[model samples]
Target: MFIFVILGLLVCTEAQGISAGTPVFVLKGEDLLLNVTKAVVLGKFDDFSWKCNKSNIVRFTFNDKGASPHYTGRIEFPENNFSVKLKNLQEADSGVYTAVVMKDSGDETEAKYSVKVQDRASLPLLTVSSVSESSSSCSFTVTCSSQDSHINSTFTCDTRTCSQEGGERSEGIPDTFLQVYQSSGSIICNHSNHVSWTNDTNTIKDVCHQQDDPEGLSVCLVKTCVFSVGLIIMVSAVITVHLMEKLNKNK
Candidate 1:
């Protein structure tokens, strides 16, 4: 009997820990609705209350209801259910919220939620750092940046398709991520979190063609210099040979 009781207590503690760790993500200035999964019958329960970080935010009895002064105008309890709606969530409001129920039969039930409020992710920026082109293919290096994070990735593209040479690159914040990848003919930089996402895109053809003009001009200049040097050398050699023949004839 003693062993069975100890096992039962351990199981109950584990279950409670799992429930208390339920994560809820919300955007800043957004409203969050927290619901109790278990049924709450008014007549069977003596009282119920909702607490945040161990501080009571709302309390309800069979006939009476009250809310904490700190949450006076920002909370709502709907008549249709035992759900609490929190409005205008801010970073300061992020905490663990628990709903507790006390029954007349000396029983208690509780549900916990861990809430995190975050701002929307900023827009991502994509820039090409260097590009190389050949007759059949083009390759380039690009950097993707968002906020304080950045990633560098290389891509190769042909006439028909584009592929990433070193796969995708990514950086992560607490709950946010920045990534660079290829899709279709474009390279995309994405910044995202559980609440919001943004991206920037550029085409492979456009980036490669932009670099080709300067490279082509440099190649043309080199070819012109080589041809001019060759012509000058040939003319000098012919003049020297003609002079030598004339001098020999005079002698």
Candidate 2:
């Protein structure tokens, strides 16, 4: 049951970063048996720091059980020689880990390992709204949000319809889905309303898709009818002249 237990209170959420050293990770309550004598953190030196203290660890803020929790963790090196086990994990308990190693000559090497908990994929709330109405289509925008203050994620937008998304947000308003077409659950049915690039548009117009096309098509109908009537008149005049010539010849 010998394990290196790093306390869970240290989440990296400030301007000061970890010292230029190695990082390591171990479960809070998990027991591990090491076949090798040592382990250390490995990866890029810039994004994380190594060690088990405030100067050497990175913090991740997450939600836990009914409350919130913080993860102050570091990466440990040389995992192949040792085995690790975890007891309990919370939202504040993500295992994105790396390690840094310093040799006698002062040159550094990095080891990397990713600690991912499979059970927690908290889907944020997705909100869709109609913005404006255009001639042909409608657009809806979607936004995802989480209650935790520390987790800011970049969002990617996509849908089966022809609607598009623009301006990816990482700080706030992670993503938005534009409601363009009037589908089963849509609030409106106008192309302009459905195809806005932002989520804050307050316009709620529902121009009919079929009505717009018909108005444009009416111009073509007028030309077609005129041509048809002209052809009929020409045929009628020619037939009348021929009938008169035949009757006069017979008389």
Candidate 3:
């Protein structure tokens, strides 16, 4: 049975005569719509069928034979329509899908598709590697990490923009891509796939501390001054008390 199924797929793939639009990217676990042009004369065609990865997914016949049992209840075929709707898609469902319309005259109309199931890109991470300042400008080196932590890329940012320097891409990660953009004083690192995208942003002033210092420096300075004043007051009071006691004892 498996051998026959594989052979059937091979035959269908080879028999696929016409192709449609570019590959469709669909989010995993969502419904997918595989479109096929509606036959002009609904009564002329004897059977309309759909296949995924060359496996018979559903079929509709003029005789009311119904769809294939494998996709029963999970698939929808509107009356007189060649399009198909698949629900609760999984990664396994990602593949080439074909639709074939067979007419009473023995003619067939076909269309092919390459469907990809992807998940929305997760949030990425941005890290600062180093910051250097000059009289004129500040330069910063930053790293962006993929959502899955599989790919790490380094980029350099000047006053204007951020550009990629180097990176390592790991195998077996699906639908991974990296992008960097700088706007105003902010640098954004974006990670995406065909289905979705996510990004992390950092401001130039925060990373490089371009001015006198970061806001945190003011707080540190305040704390240091308070501590020094408290210490000096305590020492002065102790010395004054000691000298008064000595003078009284001498008297």
Candidate 4:
């Protein structure tokens, strides 16, 4: 029993009573195309399926579909090819596609397609909340969080932990002091490739003013000004009273 195959560009297995088949390997997040150049007779395949493998992983499958009867005509590739769709696949989906050919002449041809999957980076994140304006006397807290993580690692993180900082990561509470000259109300935050950042790119579009001081709304600044003015008035009054007492005592 011999199997003869018609492959393009490569001719190596063409001997009588010889049956040969090979396996194809593709990477993750990728597609692959395969064709039988050699003639595989009908009536030989009992079972055919796909299987994927990774570390600490074993055989895997995609579609457990059988054939459509032997050789009504050979299925051409690329136009309706099986190999072209194996590109840019996922790591969990990487595996082997086994094709079993049962020949009427008591011969069998077995072929396989092996694939490897890759990782793709996802979009970033954005959040807006409170800042120094939340309170005039108390502290205000604002935080940004991202959704990306290292797919293959173990981690423990606080609000500021990132994938690049292996193992456990903790972020310290930060308090940034800024002059509240105006009410800057808008915030922009971004999360990209497992990283997070923020800014006031909205140009502080809308800052509501206090009813008492419509022109200047920052209570922190107003309080400081009131304290300074009161101190100055008290000092001036004390100096004038002391001068009057001295003049009266001299007379």
RMSD of each: 11.4, 15.7, 12.1, 17.8
lDDT for predicted candidate 1 compared with the true structure: 0.82
Model 2: residue 49 alpha-carbon error in angstroms? 19
CA lDDT, candidate 4, residue 65: 31
- Maximum-TM-score candidate: 1
lDDT of 1 by residue, 1-251 (tens): 99999999999999887767689999999998878877887774478888899788888888888899999999997656577898899989999998877675764656788899999999989999778888767888988988788888888766566677653546567888888887766788889998999899997768765333433444666889999999999999999999999999999
State which candidate has the highest lDDT: 1
The model with the greater lDDT, 1 or 4, is: 1
Expressed as tens digits, the lDDT of each residue in 1-251 for candidate 2 is 12322222233322123333222333333422212235543333322233222223432112111111222232232344322322355324444433334443463424333333223223344444453435444444544443431221122212222334442333422222222222332322111111122222221222223232323554567889999999999999999999999999999
Q: Show model 3 residue runs off by greater than 4 Å.
A: 1-21, 40-45, 103-107, 147-174, 211-251
Query: Could you give candidate 3's per-residue lDDT for residues 167-228 as a string of tens digits?
Result: 54332366678766566667777888888888899877676543334333555678899999
Q: How high is the CA lDDT of each candidate model?
A: 0.82, 0.35, 0.70, 0.34
32: Cα error in model 3, Å: 1.8
Q: Write the per-residue lDDT of candidate 4 for residues 1-251, one digit (tens) a residue.
A: 13343452135443321232243333333455544344432323332222233121111123333223321132223432122223334545545544443333452434454443333322323222342332222112223333332111121212221121121222322211111111223333322221222322222323212222334355787889999999999999999999999999999
Tell me each candidate's TM-score: 0.71, 0.28, 0.64, 0.24
Query: How many angstroms is residue 88 displaced in model 4 relative to the true structure, after the best TM-score fit?
Result: 5.4
TM-score of model 2 vs. true structure: 0.28
- lDDT (Cα, 0-100) at 98 in candidate 2: 38
Please identify which of the two predictions, 1 or 3, would achieve the higher lDDT against the true structure.
Answer: 1
